[model samples]
Target: MNRDGAAPTMKGGQFNTDPIAAPNEAATAALSQAEFELFAELGRPRAVEAGQVLFRRGELGTTMFIVASGAIDLDFGDDLVTKRLGPREFFGELGLLIGDHARSADAIVAGAGLLIELRHEEFQRLVDRNPGLVCHFLRRAIMRVVLNEQGLIRRLRRRNQDLEAALDSLYATTHQLNQTEELIRTDELTGLYNRRGLTLRLQESRAIGMPASLGLVLVDCDRFKQVNDDHGHLAGDRVLQAVASILRSVAGPEDVACRLGGDEFCLLVASSNAGDVMRFAEFIVATAQNLMLMPQSPPAMCPVSVGACMVDPRADWNDWYARADEALYQAKRKGGNRVHWQDAALEPV
Candidate 1:
């Protein structure tokens, strides 16, 4: 679109004399007064017919033309994508200023046109004499380069902001996933490891072949259902929590305790000997017996039966657990508050 008031002139025999039709005329006239006089002496107005080709792509040229009226279409490619220029717009100056280089784009008449042709040799001589005109063109080129730089900076800033947002979202999602994993592998009532967690750790222990011996201790709160019925489920939960605290206090750092279900719990002690397992079971029984006399109502006494067995790597986890469970039954049979140990060879004793 022609924002300025310049218009193209017809190509045929029509000629224009108006000076306002040329872009930057006032500046050019002031800078090239002597050359303007020379142009008036040597050159004449030229006319171009409608639909005529002004310049073809790749055509070697040494002159530039300024539109005096009408419009010309610029074609950069075969798809015919064209940009229309009108009214004082100039073209062919780039090739003219640079040597006999071929035109990069085709220029054709959109309508009948009038133009003022300036020979490159004369224009160069004029610019050499008038430094002001050369400075003005140079200033314009620098301004265009600065504007392009600003546009690129804006795009880069937007991309950086988007990347930061994406990273923040990913971090939040990972934190939530960790919390979910903890909940899934923990016992809600006793705050101890669940079966799944114990199994996983056991596999890792076996894989490493660390300490030679591992032991499982099975524990059952005596008459736990009676406690729940007499004192309500809340009191039973408090009792479980207290018992878990005591176990944690006694267990070694390498040991793990798991709540199997309801009132049953299990402990896995790494690298513990048969004597250590026996002593730990005895400690559990004595601790629970002492808690029985604490001034809590409803549940008659806090007491437990414990059974332990050394793990056999040659056997499956279930088989190891079953032996410990049978030993616990034997302890309960003997009395509700006692400790029992299973033979490492797992004979039916």
Candidate 2:
């Protein structure tokens, strides 16, 4: 007797946990009606009461039971009954076939039932009288083992596929999250870093110890309000976009380009010295000077006043911003369209 009680031989001679042919079960263990009746004759009839414990799991089983009328419930002491044997069904035969076998599951009469119990002595007597019984039992027993193993393998494969799908879904979600976070820190208008992005860059720069020169460049479009009034706000917007383009082209991926709103834009560059900062500022000043707003409006020179400063490792981010602001103020005072760089380390651009 096993967890599924016993296997029944189906048409064409096959065995399964249940007698019915199932796509999931084994091939049929076919037997003639005469042979089945001869087998059934080996059992002795017994009346079982409803709630009667016929046999229990782990007991050294010596007898097999066949359900003649009513039903038999199979359990393993748990409330979830595993199987129910109805009319014309047989179970526990494996125990009788194999000498000194222990019952793998418990059998209880579901209701008042008519059962035929066949002991090992009766089974042996039948085998002696008709040796064909030995052949039938061996063939059906082997088929049961094969079919059960195949079922377990199929279940395991399905479980592995589910786990793989879960892992792929997790990876896709993580990638989407990364892209969303990148968008959150980006400016909608110019595709540049926003103020929040710039602040994060500053924090990263400050975290690094000395021997690093962090560069800051402030680019302000000179007389930007006059452009809006002259051509319209659209023109002013175009001017600002042009400035952002120039700054982006001059900065590397390691550098951060940001629009600080209004006519102010900033760049944070990873520089080895002050010269790198000055060269970047010069490129912005040169490119912006050649910008043409419209063909109708005489070449509108959108000159940008740039203020460049190198970070003092000992100084904080605010100190560097203040120095860059002062440099920008100097460039504005000296008439826009020029670079005012602090530190005599780099010549005025």
Candidate 1 residue spans exceeding 4 A from truth? 1-134, 203-211, 298-301, 344-349
Q: Which candidate achieves the best lDDT against the true structure? A: 2
Q: lDDT for model 1, please.
A: 0.69
lDDT of 2: 0.73
Candidate 2 has a TM-score of 0.61
Candidate 1: tens digits of C-alpha lDDT, residues 168-226: 98999899888887778788777788888777777886797746668888989988888
Q: lDDT score, residue 49, model 2?
A: 92
Using all chains and alpha carbons, the TM-scores for the candidates as numbered come to 0.60, 0.61
Q: Which regions of candidate 2 are displaced past 4 Å?
A: 1-137, 204-211, 293-301, 344-349
Model 1 residue 228 CA deviation (Å) reads 0.8
**What lDDT does candidate 2 reach at residue 40?**
66
